[model samples]
Target: MPIEKFAPISRAACIGGGVIGGGWVARFLLAGIDVRLFDPHPDAERIVAEVLANAERAYGLLTSAPLPRRGRLSFCASVAEAVEGAQWVQESVPERLDLKRRVLAEIDAAAPAEALIGSSTSGLKPTDLQEGLTHPGRLFVAHPYNPVYLLPLVEIVGGAQTVPATVERAKAVLDAIGMKGVVIAREIEAFVGDRLLEALWREALWLIKDDICDVETLDDVIRYSFGLRWAQMGLFQTYRIAGGEAGMRHFLAQFGPCLQWPWTKLTDVVDLDDTLVEKIGAQSDAQAAGLSIRELERIRDENLVGIVQALKAGQSGEGWGAGKLLKEFEQRLWAQAGHTAPPVDMKAPLELVETRVSPAWIDYNGHMTEHRYLQVFGDATDALLRRIGVDLAYVEGGHSYYTVETHLRHLDEAKLGEGLVCTTQILATDEKRLHVFHRLHAGPERREIATGEHMLLHVDTSAGRATPAAAQVLSALDAIAAAHAGLERPAAAGRAIGHKARLATPA
Candidate 1:
């Protein structure tokens, strides 16, 4: 097996400033890659700016990894100027074959020979996309989902002239920027993910056309049902688990016969005739009520972030599917933040986590609830682990730290939207044990609101026994412990839960 290495590209060029193109610009810029964009439309710059703003907000809620400084976004006057020195060039013009070929040819002519040229076509074949190009081998389909910055899936398709190296290079770029690059074995129009999407969409249109369900009802049918499952495990794995003890083979045996049933309307697409179009459009308008397209997009992005983060919270072992993808993306964020098990300021505790309280953390009393404090502390602990080199990959290797005990002291309340920071001080450390204290402060004045003392045990997960941590992790822990040895012990440490000393002598 050939191991794939990640190759980071520092600069990217985006041609076309429509929705997909704008999203590409945002993804590249947020990944710390400078972007040179070329789009003749008058509103191109404005559209890209809006997309970038939305991406930044959505990503802020998605992860806390220290992100690199913002990469510069330059709007170039011509395609040649945009791809002049770009390490990667992406063409995201309208879904017209002739237009794409012209734009791609222009990009291929200007981009450096080593630079990979990717088309953001939803369904166009790569062979068609590469036609009339000088270096067709460098061109491939790198289709991404909408709001590309948050979604990690990218379908990579290679044409007849495209070599394995070109496909690998595209994969490297996608992986480096925190995406799941799934290569199609053969070139096909619409690729894989979109084909599945189209099937569902076609079925949905037919159902709505036949008045079987309205827009809101149909959306509810999915969102309130299998949509949740698809966000994590996906269809096959979900059905496999539904097979119970018999597993996938049993599932196929049970449901295999249904494949021949004429139950699905996916065999044909519904014509969008005037009457059907009006009905669908009216139903959609009613579903939207008064929300603008931008508002709707915001809601969609927010929900996606929350759902994906929920999946991330469920990751364990070698996390599968979307949960695994979320974990990997977060790891990339941490790595970009420059966090490592290295010597730091020995004089004071390390401030590991900083975030503002979200509305979801607020309770009926209008302040952050008790359990929210624990969530923050947990995030802080995860940050501490990451700093000590106990990241996702490390834990996946069969070594991890499990919290054996915890004591939380809620001295004050944290209000919604208040800035909170968690400073961690290592109290004690040994080969297999770690003792740490965390202080959670709120607001600009750093008013102390909560504190947590924890005892964690390093365990060899594969052996199901406590074990000494890796040398690098131990060194990092010991360094922090040594630095804090001179500081006064926290009064909250080692405290038992008792209101006061009771006068038990009378009893």
Candidate 2:
């Protein structure tokens, strides 16, 4: 299962733009945000470009259809300009409390009051991170795992000062950026992901230090068993199924006997001896040997993508997934549209129009007004997007365009009932922008009536800014125009394409 540009993030700001920060920036950009980077460190541009390239590839693995083009990323001279009107500011400075405080202060000062400021602090609580902010209520801990572009979980926890509205808005932002965020009801140290992983880290060190097994062996033990299940469905949910209809109570009763046993012990901490540390670290390196970090990262991302898709498909251990819910959404829309099937020629192009006059077009003398000619050309532009792409399906993915500029020239006008026809021509296109020229003609007379020029920019709905069209779709548009070029342009009302992916899998 897959989702293509599930939601959109139009504009975002990333404060640190280092490895992790750069990853965060890439994730936002790929989801169609015009992200601003505010890092002062050197090599910032190099890191961001690298991360962006990797993110595009990772996003490709998640879906087969064309993904929206990577949004433009700019390196701002200061944090203030980078975050001034941003809807979301992701602060990823070094985890020192003092540094975090300074960054938060700057964001709170510069960002819009309605904007949400979140820190990517792994273990820092909201109070710790927002200690010096002007309005700490809008600040919260939004800890995302490493390699954020591929992994999708972000743990959100807030302090006493945090407002629930801000937290909910942050969650909506996360959804638009295609990430899962779990909001912790109460602020806690270490947050959820670290707390869950800490238990495993302690036990893994014990086996290596006690000479029971090597690091590779211990990792394999869990990866072969628990890792597979955890990927598709978490442990608690898995146990619910294990208990049958009796649920948690039955599972607890069955496992209660082992509570007193030493199988599980959280009170003990294993000290890492120097020799053992060297041995395991080198072995771990050996296990990961011969591959560059980039290569390893690609492999890891591919695996995660496959696992996540499986979970979404309900074919993995999780018996139910998002695909089922989405089918209902599709079915609901289909029902609303009625069972009556649209004509197969709904996408057919009319060769010509015999009549184009309307009551609104008539003046006192029943002659068509000059403005009506331009109106026909304007309608032609709408016909083009639906023909090329950006139909209902693309719009649902938050991929639509707005005309920023237009120029019209009217050559002739006819009587109220006179015939008029129109033709559209593709002017030019790039990753994020499109330009077109349209013509309206006096039908059968073979005389030009009106022509207009237009320039449009793709937009992301969530952040309310321009972004680029998806790659595969841009290519499809090119192919479509090439096919129709030099052929008589036809009327489009009877020829609109439906808003649905031809073959894209749904999640």
Candidate of highest lDDT: 1
Candidate 1 CA-lDDT value: 0.84
Candidate 1 has its poorest 10 consecutive residues by lDDT at 498-507
Worst ten-residue run, lDDT, model 2? 344-353
lDDT of 1 by residue, 1-507 (tens): 132432678899999878889989998998889999999999998888888888887776566666666789999999999999888899998999988888888898889987888899999999988788899998899999987887888899999999788888888778777788899999887888988999999999988988899989999999999988888878999999988899999999998999999988987878999999899899899999999978887788767776766666674644556656767866677655544434557668788787766545667998889998898888888888887788878888999999999999899988755778898888888999988899999999999999999999999998999999999998977877887999888878887566345335555
Candidate 2 local accuracy as lDDT? Answer: 0.70
Model 1 spans with C-alpha error above 4 angstroms: 1-6, 239-269, 313-317, 332-349, 356-372, 378-405, 411-419, 425-436, 442-448, 454-507
Error of 2 at 186 (Å): 0.5
Q: What lDDT is reached at residue 247 by model 2? A: 93
* C-alpha lDDT of all candidate models, in order: 0.84, 0.70
Residues 8-90, model 2: lDDT tens digits: 44778899998789999988887667888899988899877887777766654453222344688889999999996687899
